[model samples]
Structures are given as structure tokens and as C-alpha cells.
Target: MYCVQCEQSNKGGCAVKVGSCGKTAPVADMQDVLLRIMQGVSAYASLAAQKGARDAEVDAFTPHAWFTTLTNVNFDADRFTALIAQALDMRAKAKACAVAAGADLSDLPEPATWNPGTTASELAAAAPFAAIQRFMDRDGPSIVGLRNLVLYGLKGTAAYAEHARVLGHEEAAVSAEFHRIAAFLATDPTDVSALLAQSLAIGALNLKVMELLDAANTTRFGHPEVTMVRMTPVQGKAILVSGHDMGDLEVILRQTAGLGINVYTHGELLPANAYPGLKRYSHLVGNYGGAWQDQQRDFDAFPGAIIMTSNCLINPEIKSYADRLFTTGPVGWGGIPHLTGHDFRPAIARALELEGFTQDAPEQRIPAGFARNTVMGVADTLLDLIGKGEVKNLFLIGGCDGARPGRNYFHDLALATPKDSLVLTLGCGKFRFNREDMGDIQGIPRVLDMGQCNDAFSAIQVAVAVAGALGCGVNDLPLHYAISWFEQKATAVLLTMLHLGIKKIHLGPTLPQFLTPEVLGVLVDEFDIRPTGDVADDLARMLKAA
Candidate 1:
């Protein structure tokens, strides 16, 4: 099995023997089969939609299928078996409908019917390991790379779409586009122009999905507010919830309330402190660690159960603590138990079983609780400061944080920002500058935390408001976007910026492996996108450009 959908691909290429993320050959093969089944399901769903069938049914299945195929979301063979079976069944049903309507179709075998029995040897023997091999043999590297890129991007979009679905905001068009791309991936390799159009369409549809999620989060949680959160460990039996899903965090917080189990935000969940609805939970403790990359070390020390809600899950090395790790909502791996059907009771019970610390450790505090609503509440004051020239410039510097050494660029750039400027950050990337004593300017915090990666929506909202108040387009505002992206959500956000014509944004530590030179050219020409260099030089260039 060959896998190259993430940063840690074996030797910076495909993971042929075992996944860099700790997936075995059989699991990787099953994942590939699951992906093929999903594509088949998408093809059938797209055809159904075109033929005037019910769109909601198609929408319900589209995003979760893509979400399940994301980098580290699902490794559980049982879960994957069920999902593949469901997709193949859907495909078969759609084919039957098409036939009744007098349409002839290729008779493809159903993917779900292939059963991988419980035993490792039996599962390996039963799974379709050869199918993916044949497909890869038939496809060129460029075609395979593009398909992987689009598939990964869809995974990211599906994650956000699923989050929004939990909050009751549905966009049928976004779902349709996902199905469209999935269907496209199944077809024979197309011309470059057609593929390019489909690639851009992924970007376009992603914007709608992000918007829907942004709306769902802000509307349900109340706009995030600028508030300080302690990093100190509180005394009690507690559970750590990581990844980007606030809905899951909220539910976990609610369920753990009377159970004597405290809940602490980890990774992307660090931003949950900004939301009024989530923050009001008395038992909701502060953030415990930095980014997703540090989890192996961080999780080792923490005695409580850890629940991963989304991407960037690196498999743990300690096999003894396997039962202590719980995952839900698009995050999974082989041998790890996942919370199914939105039921987190198992996670809470595990937290209780492990018990927590008997006493609180010395408390440490860091400012959190900055999101779009929080920023906008003080917008008038910010505008007034800008009008009087008290605030010189604004820097929107945040994105995914990784193990890369160059990520120090964010800290250096934040440090280099003039004292008169305000720095806005979100996601784990903020950990770089969040610890810095940036100080306040006229009662407004110099460094504003805008929640998780999806909360880049909050940053966009603040940018638009600030620009409107300053009587200029968003590009004309004294703001620059220097973002570090690790996954597909970042891809979707960058596309949204392009869709809105926001220009002169800087991205790093390196560009996506999936971006063709020609596609990169389109971004450079259309959005004035550039890669990050020396922080001092970049700052000078951005100021000069402004």
C-alpha cells in the first residue's frame, strides 16, 4: 500500500510498508479500499442528484465519507468495515434506481461486501490489497498526486461540514460538490484543464462549507470574547479534549459536569475558552499543552484519558496506554477505540476509571478567549485607535503548528511587529507568540487570540470590519496575513481568502506537495500569494507594500 496524503509520509514520499502515522500495511490497504468505495458512492450520489433525487440523503453521507478518509481520522478496522459496507450499499441502491430509469451503467462489484474477519491474518487475507495496487499501476504520478490532494482537501472540508452539521447548519451545494469531486476521482484521468477546473471547484465549494461552519459556531457558541485562560493544572480527575471540534468539547464538558471529572482543552480545543457558552462551564479547565505534534510527550505525562476529535493525530508509541486514548468525530486509527454516534459516555467513563490528580499544581496563565465576536465587541474602540493613529498596523499571523524548525518564523515575526501594531492569531500556531509579553495599547491587548483554525473566519470578520471602519477595501487595511498551514483546513481558508479577493498573504513553512507549479502560478497572479522568508525582510516588504 502506498500513502502520501500527509507531511510525515515515509521519506517524504509514499509510505509503502507501514504508514508514518503508525498504520500497518493491511490497515492502509483497507483505507484505500474504503476510499475507492467512497468514490463509487459519490459517483452514484452525483448521478442521483443530477436526476432530481432527494439531495439531503446524498448530503448526509458525502462529508462523513470524506472526513473518514482524512489523514489520521479513522484507523479502526471495524469502523472502516462498516463505513465501506454502507457506501457500497448506497452505490448499489443508486445503480438500481438508475437502471429503473432506463440508464445503463458499468457493473462494479460492491466494496462493502468484502468482509475482513476479526482475526489479523483473516482480515489481511480477506481485504482488497490488490485493487489499489492495480489502480496505482494504471495512474500516473501527477494524476495520483492531484487526486490525493483533492481528496485530502475534501477531507478537511468534510470535517468542518460535519462540525456544522452537529450545529444544524446544512449546505446542500457544498455536499453536492464533494460528491462531484469524488465521482471525478473515480473516472479516467482527464485533460489538465478539466482537472484544474475541478481542483478550483474544490476550493470554491470549500469556501461555502467553511462559511456554514463559521456561522454555526458563532451563532451557537456566541462570538468568542477576549479572555485569559490559565495553563496551570487544576486539582481533580480530568479529561483532555483535543482537535478542532467545539461541539464535541461542549458535549464533553456538559457530560463531565456532575461526574467529578474536569475537562481541559488541548490543541485546537484551546480556543474553546473564548466562547461564552463553552467557557461558562465551571469545570472547564484551561489548555494543557501546545500543538498536535507535542502530543506523544504531553499525553505521556497527563494521567487522564485523552480524546482526539479531528486531524493531526500521531499514533502513540506506548501500547500499554492504548485503552486510555479515546477518539471521536473523524479521528481514528487501528487498535484505538472511537466514540461512535456522538455518544461520549465511554470517554467520560474512561476518564473516571483513570481518576485524576488529587491536588492542583501551581497555576500558570495565558491570555485566550479572543475570537471574532470578542474582537468585534471592541471594534469601535479599535477603529477609534486606528483613526487617531494609535495603532500603526495589524498582523494576522496564525495557522497549523508542526514539528518543523522554521515555524519559529511566526514567533520572530510576531516579536518584530512594531509596538504600535496589534497581532491577531488563532490555531495552535499562536503558541509561538501567545507566551510573549506583547503588552496592551490603549486598553486593547496587543496580541489577540481568535480561536481555532476555523476561527480564521473570525479573523476575516474582524479584518472586514476594520477595513470598513477605515474607509478602504480589506486589502487596503493595515493588516497582513502571514499564515503557516499544515493540513487541508488551511487550504480551504486560503481559498476563501482568494475567493474574497484578499491579497498579499504570506504562507509557509513550505508549500503544499500537491500544488502544481501551474496552480501555484494562478494563486500568485490572482491572490498575490508569497511564501515566508526572513521575518525581518518580510515585515519590511509588507510595510513597504502597504
Candidate 2:
């Protein structure tokens, strides 16, 4: 068992005994098995989709399955053990569709040919047969790394696509592209040039995924308005919603409308408070806690039920509150209660039963949801300020946050930015410095929170708009990127940034472990991707790049 997919990978040793993210060796191996078998399913699904055969269940399940294996999404060995059987069923359905279209099945890999046992114990044994580590030959780390890079990007796209799908939005093109890349990886293509092309194609696909999510969120709830959200907990029966899913949060808000429960946004969901449709609710309160990494203590102190709607879930520290830890959609832990439908009675009931804060916490608030429309609404005024030399540069400093010492660099970087320079942030990484006051540049806020990581579309939209007004390409604008990455979702965001011709991105807490020196060298040469050094040095370096 070996796993080093995230930024917090081991220094001198392999994670054969246990993953740095608290995943057991057996669970890590099973996740690999799940990913390998997914490629097998995709091999058939890709061919079937080509023949004008489409299955909504199969299309949606592909993303759902991929997202489950992401770090911290699911650590229950039994869940993967159960998912393997479901994979066999999906594979059989996809195979039948391919056979009906007379697609060639003979060249399919062993994963496509091998069938898992029906019993749980037998299924557990068969997972080892699908391990991905067997294909890592050191001779071609660049090739293997690029292939896996595409796979990781696909995983991130799957998560974004699933978020959109849950909101009753499904794009066949997104699903088809995902299956296409998964199947291509199964063939083990080793050509460096071709693999590089496929990797960028995944980036293009991610762009579409983010667009769909943007439409889904904005269309369902009105375009996010720039609003201030109170940080202090309101005195009442409270429930905190975290992660990136706006769909579930809407449903939960509706279900608990008149139940005397005050819903508070936490982590990435902090942006939800800016949506007019969401903020209209009477019981909808302010945000609580910091980012996903700090959930152990945050979730412990909160005296109410917790709803983890998506990824960035940590195992709860409070044993008593663990009962209140509820999982929904793609997120799941071993013993947590999961909500299958929009009905969140258990979470609501728990909130009613638990004793919320006896008194109102101190008054504090933060700004969020500077989504494209809201940012652009005031774009003319901001543009005037930029033209007058009041607004100098724009810095985007946000992505996944990790439990590492170097992460504090993000916190300090925000503080070091000149008041004349506007700072834009999204994703959980903003938690490091979000609470600190950067104040406002003129009437515009100095630091803008642009929603979740999936809302990279908003950042892209703002960049394109700025470039259009300035009569230059996005790369030619005064904007510089210091994006942090922890998982595949961040990988997809990086690929999209590169695809848009944006360069000189400083990525840290640490670089991905999957990239070999050769692969890392290729990115450094082609895209100018650099690992972040000292906060002051990196900030000066990025400012100089503009």
C-alpha cells in the first residue's frame, strides 16, 4: 500500500503503513483499486457514448464514483468494498451497451475483463488485482506522471460535474470527455507529446465543468450578491453547512425554514450568505469556523449538528459530536449518518435536541461572493480607480489549505500585499488570512472572496473582463497567480489556468508528489510553475512578474 497523492506527503519514507491523511493502508489500496476499475468502466462507457447510446445513471455515476476516492472524501474501507460491487454492475451495463453498438471489446485491458466476486470478502481480495502502482515504471516517470496527471484532473472535473448534476444540470459533453480520458489512461499511452496534449484537453474539459457549476449555482440561487456575513453564532438551535455543494444547502435551508433552526455557513459555504435567494431566509445566520483543515476544533466547539455536504471533511475530534456529524452527497465517513434525500430530519432533529449557544457570540463579520457579476457591477468604478493609479495590481491567493507549517505563508502574504494592490481569493486556502482586515481600496474591498474552488470560473471571468477592458490578453493583464494545490481538484484548476495562457503561477504549500523531476521540469519550462519559497520573496517575485 503506497499513497502520496496530496501536498502533505511523507518526507523520506513511503506511506505503505498509513496515509498522511489518516487513511489506513487497506483503505488506500482499495481506493487505488476503485480508481483502476473506474477506467475499465469508462473504456466501455466511452465507446457506448460514441454510438449514440447514453445512460443518465451511468453518466452521473462516473463522476460520483471518481469524487469518492479523492483524499478525505471517503476513508471507510467497507464503502469502497461496497462500491467495487456497484462498479461491476455499472461495467456490465456499459459493456452491454458497447456490445449492442458492436464496439471492439477484445483490446480492452484486464480491468475490463476481470470480474469481481459477489461476496464482500471475495470482492476485497479482487481489489488488489486492480492496483495502479504496478504500472509505475521509473524509466518513464514523466510519461506515467502525465497520464496520472490527466486522471487526477479528470477526478477533479468529476467532482465539479457532480455538483452541477445534483442541481438538475447535466452536460453530456462533460461526462463524455471524462469517460474518454479515463479510457485513454487505461490504454497506458506512453508517448510524451500525445500525453501532454491529452493533459491540456482535460483542462479544457474542466473549464466547461466550472461553467456548468456556475450556471447551476447562479441560475438556481440568484447570482451571488456582494454581502457581509456575520461570523458570530446566533443564539438558537443552529446547524453549520460546510464544503462546496450549494444544492444540498438550499434543500436543507428549505427543510429547516420554520423549525427554529438557524443555519450558519462554514468554510467554502461561507459564500452562500451572499446569494440573495439564500439570505432571504429568516433562520439563515452567519458563518462559523475557519477552513476544512480546522474543522476538528471548530466542529468541537459548535454546540449544534454539523452537515458536511462535500469534500474537505476531516474525521471529527469530538466523540459526542460525532453522532451529529452527518454526511450527504459524495462525502462519507465510517459511522456518520448520511442523508440520501433532501430530507434533513436527522440533522434538524439533532439541532433541536442539542443545546446551542446560551448567549450570542461577539459581533464579527467578513465579506464574500465577489462573483463575476457582483465584481463587474462595480467594475467601472474599480476600473476608474485603476486608471487613476489608485489600484495597482491584482493578486489571486487561494486554493486548498493543508495542515502544514508552510501554509501560514498564505496568511502572511495577504498581510504583506500593499493596500494599493487588490487581493482576490477563493477556495478553503483563504481561511488562513481571510479573517484579517486588508481593508478596502477606495470604495472597493481590498480582499475579495470569490466563492469556492469550483467557482474558479468567476475568477477566470473577472480576469477576462479585465483583459478585455485593458485591450490585452489575460496573460498581459496586471494579475498574477499564487495558487495553492492539495488534491486533484486543484490540479484541474491549474490545468485550466495554463490552458488559458496564464503563466508564472506560484504553487505551494508543496508540489504534488505524482510529478517526477522530469515532469516537474517540463511544467517549469513550459508554464513557469514554481514552488513557493519565503512569503516576502514570493510576494515580491509575483509582483515583479506583473
Candidate 3:
């Protein structure tokens, strides 16, 4: 199997008997088939749309299904098998509807025509396209890599949209762009120029997806405000909610509300403490972990039920926390019982049975929830400090966290930033040094977190506003972006940054494996994207700009 979509690329030939992400050959092959099936769905769905026969189910599945194929998301072979079958049925229905509405279907590719057989064995042999490497090799690296950028970026966009969809918010524009792009990838276009345009188009569309998610999150739970979340343990029967899903947290919180179970936010869910609607529940305690990569130790030590609501679920091989693990939403595992339709009773029961912390641990707190609204509220103070020559610069550092090394560079850079600069952070990357006492620049805290990766939207808003107030473009302002990415959400956020013409982005711990030299060149030439160097060097370079 060959998969070079993340930073763990092996010269774009990442062929292994087993994937580095722990996907076996059979599972990787099925995943390819699954993606191909969606291409077929895209083809038929596009045709169906011309006939005004759009399917909301398939539209929603566009992102939901794509997100499952992301790195470290879904590895259950059986789940992929079931998903492929359902995809075939969905494509057939879409095709039937489009044709009945007088739409032509003759131009669709083999993905739209091939039949994935009834079982897993048949699927491995029945894949219609050549191996991913071979097919991508037919075109130069630039063409293939550019197309992949759009594919991964759109996958990220869809994941964000899916989160909003669960909260009863759906944007038709996002669905249309996802279908259009999926079909575009299905054709395997060789024109790098066209692919570049499509990449930017996906970026523009992602901006909308981010905006929609912002509205969904803020409207549902209220805009995140300044809140101090405890970093230590609170003694009680506990449930740790992780991932980027608020709806999942809300449901389980509602179930365990009157009960003695205390729900502590973990990983990306830490921002839940800032929302008035969620914080209204008195039992929703504090945060307990750092990044998703550190969860094995945290979960192992935790004494209550653990909920895997979304991506970054623990590998059954590396650690066996699945015994006490319960999953919901799009994330799942082979042995873990997934909560269906918000029925979290089993998880709650498991939480009650487990003995939590014996007593309150030492109290330590870290501040967060400084979202767009919160930052904007303090804009006058921040800008006034800036004008007074006290707050000299702004350093925006954040993105996904991974087990990959060099992430300590993030820790060093944050610690190295001058006290006069405002250090804004988002995503799980902040866990590197978020608890550090950076103190405050004037009255503004040195490390102002804008919530999760989804809150990158808030960071963008603050950037634009800061630029506008300074009478310059974002790239022209005394602001910079140093981002570390692990998955597609970071990809989508990068695209949005490019869409806004933000430049000189310092990205690390590694560049995407899918980016061939040619594709990386385009980013360097057009966007001035650079990889991080030594912590002192990058820190000095960031200061040099100031």
C-alpha cells in the first residue's frame, strides 16, 4: 500500500507492506476503494445536481466519509468494508436519479462504473484504478501533488462542515464545492495550472466552511470568553470528552448532568469551558490532558470512563485503553462500543463503575477561550498598547500536535518570544508550552489562546482586524504565522491563510509528504511558505522581521 498524504511521506513512494499509520495492506486497499467509490459518487452526484436532483445524505457523506479516511482516523477494516457497500448503493441511487431526470452519464470514469464486490477479498482485487502511486505517477509530481492538496484540503473543509452539520447547521455552498472538487479529482487531470486554480478554489470554499463553523459554534454555545480551566485532577466519577465535536460533549453532558459524573474537557474540547451554555452545567469540570498524542498516559492514569468522540483515537497496538474507551460520532474502533444516536447510557454506566481520583490533585490553571469576540472586545486595549510601543509585535503559533519530534521547537519558540510581543495560540500545538508562565504584555496575556483548530477562524479574524486597524494587509502587518500540522484540518486552515494572501508562513515539524518538490516550490514561490529551522534561528528570524 502507498499513502503519502501527511508529513510522514517516504519520497512520495511511501510503499510499505504495512502503512506507517498502522494501516494494513487489506485496510489500505479497501480505503483506496472507498475513496474511489466516493469519486464515483461525486461523478453521479454532479450529474444529478445538473438535473436538480441533489441528495443531502450523499452531500453530507462527502465530508464525513472523506474525514474517516484521514490519517489516524478510522482503521477498522470491517467498517471500511461496510462503508464501501453503502457507498456503492448510494452511487447507484444517485446515478438512477440523475438519469431519470434526463441527465447524461456516459462520461463517468470506471469508479462510476466498476462494481466493488460483496466482500473485502473481492474489493482488494476489484479496484478499477491502478495503484495510487502508479496513477499519480502518470502525471508529474506537481500535477499529482497539487490535486492531492485540494483533496486533503477539501477533506479538512468537510470535516469542519460535518461538525457544524451535527449542530443542525449546513451550508449548501460547501456541499456544492465538495461534490465539484471530488468529481474533479475523479477525472485525474494532468494540468498543474488547473489544479492550482482548484486548490485556491478549495481554499476559498474552506474560508466559507470555517465561517459557517464559527457561526454554528458561537450560535450554539455562545462565543467563547476568557475562562480559567484547572489543569489538575478533581476527585469524582469523571468522563473525559475529547475531539472537535461539541454536540457529542453536549449529549453526554446532558445524560451525566444530574448524575454524579463529572465531565472534564480533554484535548480540543477544552474550549467548552468558555461557552456560557456548556459552563452553565455546574458539573462540567476542568481540563485534564495536553495534546491528543499524550492521551495514552492521561487516559491510562484517569480513573473514569474515556470518550473518543472523534479523530486521534488511540492505536490498539501502541496502547490498549480501548477497554475503558467509548466512541461516538464518526470515530470508532473494533472493540470499543460506539454510542449511537446520542444514547450514551453504556458510556455513562462505564463511567460510574470506574473509581475516579481519590482526592483533588494540586490546583493548577491555564487560561483559554480568547476567541475572536473576546480578543476583539479587548482590541482597544491591545492596539493602544501597541501604539504605546509596549506590545511590540504579535506571534501567532498553533496547529495540530503529533508524536513526531522537533515539536519541542514550538516549546522553545514560545518561550523565546519577547515579553513585549503578544503570543497567540490555537489548536493542540499550544499544549507544548501553554502552561508556561509567559505573564502579560501590559494588561494582555502573553499567550492568548483562540480555542481549538476550528478557532483558527478567530485568529484569522483578529489578524485581518489588526491589519485593518494598522492600515495594511495581513502580510504587511507586524504579524506572522508559525503553524504545526498533523492532519487535514491544518491543511484547510493553511489554504484559508493563503486565500487571504497571508504570506511568509513558518510551517513545521515536517512538510507534507504528498508535496513533491514541484508542489512545494509553488507554495514557496507563491506563498513564501517555509519549514521551521532551529528554535533559536526561527525565533531570531521572527524577531528580525519585527
Candidate 4:
């Protein structure tokens, strides 16, 4: 019943009783078991791959198992327990294949029980365990915090990788690496250099995973284009699609075609409007709400069935509309129906079954017509403005948004950026400034809305392209990063930036609780990473540096 993989831990530094994200003890225990099974699968797959087995088939299930355990993704203990069993079965099948091929496979351990409802402490008290409890019992905060950070980042990467797979883009190497890391976590590896290398490797591989997803999305949906989306409700029985999976949204849009149900984007799905293929649906309406943190209130008022496609799912409070909430693709909440296996028939059925609004109501609309392809398509005009000295700089100001009050800093920073500078944003953090009227410079929109957090890949691509066009290094370009992080995907993006040598970025809404002073100091000294301060002062410093 101890969990240390998320921001909200209990008083004992783990979710010993109930998870902060509303996961019960049985669910947490099942997730841990699932992770262990994923490692076994990974270990077997790695051995198979080394023994000249087909790389694609060796251990492809590892990432899917790992992703199922991410925070806010799965709360169903029964489903998780079944998944652990499935992974164990997969491992056994792979091991048998290796043995049948005359490969030496004597070192593998017998498959452990995948049963749920047991704590690590209880398992430690029992016999014949691998002493996983001993590592969990370590008392030092520094060691435990570092372990949690690494595990959490892996969990986030697993989720993103799974979404990529759903779109038929499989990077076998990334899944293989994920399984390798999961196995490494199971062992008591004390090599600091090896652990550090693994941490950076996770970041580096996440870059490839995200690139695969980007290709999957853009190739399927066409590169995102600039198009204004109305926030107003359309006349019909409508369903709202939230979170970041455009693949799921596309499926639902296709399924609900001619069914008389209007589909609206919500949260990270708001960026779907920027994709030409997705935007072509006449019944596909505008974005419905703000960021994930604001969902309780937003969902409460909306008069339609809601489909959550990914993370940031909070526990449902109202029993009346509880049946109306549907989740899929690594997003789960207790008591909510989850659609599985690339089929959203359940969600579509629920949307139709529930009496959704039949008429359009007067609703608000905001202009969110910016994504990488759309913005880059206008790069020629932007270059013209820059060459004319009308545009001064570009500030990439976005990340995860939380309920914390200090998040106002991001809104203020976006507002405070010089009039001559453009504010580029992605993820829910853009909600703070997406609605603001930051007038364009020539033909370039000042507040450029890139896609979701994963779409940070797009931001990096834009930066590198701008650097090339300007005949300068990315760091030498008039670009500054003022990022606000609230979760692990942000962690991966920050690491990717560091891997690219992007420096002097301002980060805030509080640094990760897992970062020790020594580690924080290393980042500050090496990367010039700093916490956000007064908007005016931070702006002055960035502008002065430019």
C-alpha cells in the first residue's frame, strides 16, 4: 500500500493507506505487481533480442503494462491485476520461445504471483521474496526521492509511448529500452554513473518516442493548421473529448458521424482544431473548457457525456453524472467506465444513451489557431517581420498547469513579455494566456498555441528551425524558455531541453519536490536553470540577456 510515484504522497512519504490521486491500497499494490511483471517481460525480451530473436516481437508488451500504472490512468484494481497476469503470461511465452530456440535461459527466475491486495511490508514479512521490500524500507530521503523521480518519469514515458502505439506507430527500440529500465529498477543498482546515465537515456528515448507519436499524429491527421475554433455550444446532442489523444478523438468523430451527436474538444484535445483532417468534421465543434485542473467545475456545468483520453483525471464527485464520464487510453478514475482496445463504441453508446443537449446554447469562443505546422507555414512572413525589426524575440512560455495559486506567474509572464516578442505555448498552461488578445506582429500571431505537452517536440523543432533560418545556434536565437511544470511529462521535456543544451530557462510553480538541493544546485550551475520570480524582473533579465 505504499506508493511514491506522484506529487501527492501520504504522510509517510508514500500512499500507505489511500493514494492522493484516489487510488486505493489494493490498486497501488496491483500497480506495483504490474510493474514487476513488466520487468520480467522486459528481462526475457532483452535476453531474446540478444539471442537473435525478432526484435519487434521480443518484448513489445512492456510499455503497455508500464503505462497502465501511471497516476490517474488506472484505478480499477481488478483490471490492473488481470494486466499483471497477462504480462506474466507474456513473459512465460517469450521465455518458452527462447528455450525452444536452444538459447541458454537458466538464469531467469520463476514467475511470481500477480495477485493484488498485498502491501510491500506484508510481502517482506512473507518468505521467498526478492526483497523488494528492503529497497522500499530504505529510510534516507535523498535516495528514495531520486528513485521516485526516475520511476515517475518512466511512468509518464510509458503512457506517451502507448498512445503512439494506438496510432499504429511502434518503436520497438523504445519499448525494449523501457523494459530494460524497468528491470534495472527491480535490482539494487548502486552505480551512480549508471543510474544517471539511465536517467538521461530515458529522456533521450522519450524524445524518439515523442517523435514517433508526432509523426503518427501529423501523418494521420495531416500537419496541424491554423483555424479559429468557437467555444460556443452547437445545436445537438453533443459529446466532449478531453485530454491529448487525437487518435481517439478521430475514432469517436468517425463513429459518431450521422448519429446527430456534436463533438467538442476539451483540455489538451483543444489543439485538435489545428489539425486539418480532424477539423474537417462539420459536427466537430469547438473546445469546451479550460485546463485539466479546472475540470471539476467545468464538467459539472457541461450538459453532455465527457470522454477523457489521458491524464489529469480527478476522482468523480457526482453520482448522477458519474455514468456519463468515460475514459480511455491510460486515463482512469474509480467508478468511471473505461473504453479499451482502440474501440470507443462504449463511449459513443454512452453519449447517445444519455440525453445530451438538443439545442445550441449561447457559449463563448476563443481563438486557438496556432500549432507547429500552422506557425511554421507562416515562417516566411514571420521572418519578414523579424527582418524589418518589428518582431524582437520569441518566448516559449508553457507547461503543465495545476491548482496552485502561484501559477498566476505564467499568465503574468505571458502578459509581461515585450509587445515586440511572440509568446509560444503548449499544454494546458496555455489556458492562462490562450484567451488573451495578444495582437500579432505583421502576419505572425503573438500568442502561438502549439499542441499538447508532448507537442513540446514541435516547440523544439520550431526553435531548431528558427535557429537554422537565422544562421545561429538555437541558444543564440532570440528565444527564451519560461516553463511552468506540474508533472512528469514536463520533467521529460525539461530533460530534452537540457540534452539539447538549451540553457537559462525559467521554471516554476515550484520545482519538483523530489529534487535534492545538491541536484538542484547542479542544474542551476550547469544549465543556468532558475525558479520563476517577479514577472517584471524575469522579463527584464531575459530581455537584457537577449
Q: Could you give the C-alpha RMSD of every candidate to the true structure, in order shown?
A: 3.5, 1.7, 1.8, 3.3
Residue 1 miss distance in model 2 (angstroms): 2.0
Deviation of model 3 at 45, angstroms: 1.7
lDDT of 4 by residue, 292-360 (tens): 878888787777788888777877764345768888876666667788886877777777776676677
List clash counts for every candidate, in order: 7, 0, 0, 1
**Which stretches of model 1 miss by more than 4 angstroms?**
55-57, 96-144, 516-522
171-224: candidate 1 lDDT, tens digit per residue: 656666777777786764446566656666777787777778888987898876
What is the alpha-carbon lDDT of model 2 when measured against the actual structure? Answer: 0.84
**Residue 428 CA displacement from its true place in model 4, Å:** 0.9
- Between prediction 2 and prediction 4, which has the larger lDDT? 2
Sorting all predicted structures by lDDT, with the top scorer first, yields 2, 3, 1, 4
Encode model 2's per-residue lDDT on 32-150: one tens digit a residue: 77787788889998898888776677787888989998877887777788887788788888889889887877788766777766565665686566655566764366676777788
Better of 1 and 4 by lDDT: 1
Instruction: Give the TM-score ranking, best first.
Output: 2, 3, 4, 1
Tell me the TM-score of each prediction against the true structure.
0.89, 0.96, 0.96, 0.90
Give per-residue CA lDDT, model 3, range 179-257, as digits (tens). 8887888888788788888788878888888888899998999988799988888888988888878888888889998
* lDDT of every model, 2 decimals: 0.75, 0.84, 0.82, 0.74
Give the 10-residue window scoring lowest on summed lDDT in candidate 1. Answer: 107-116
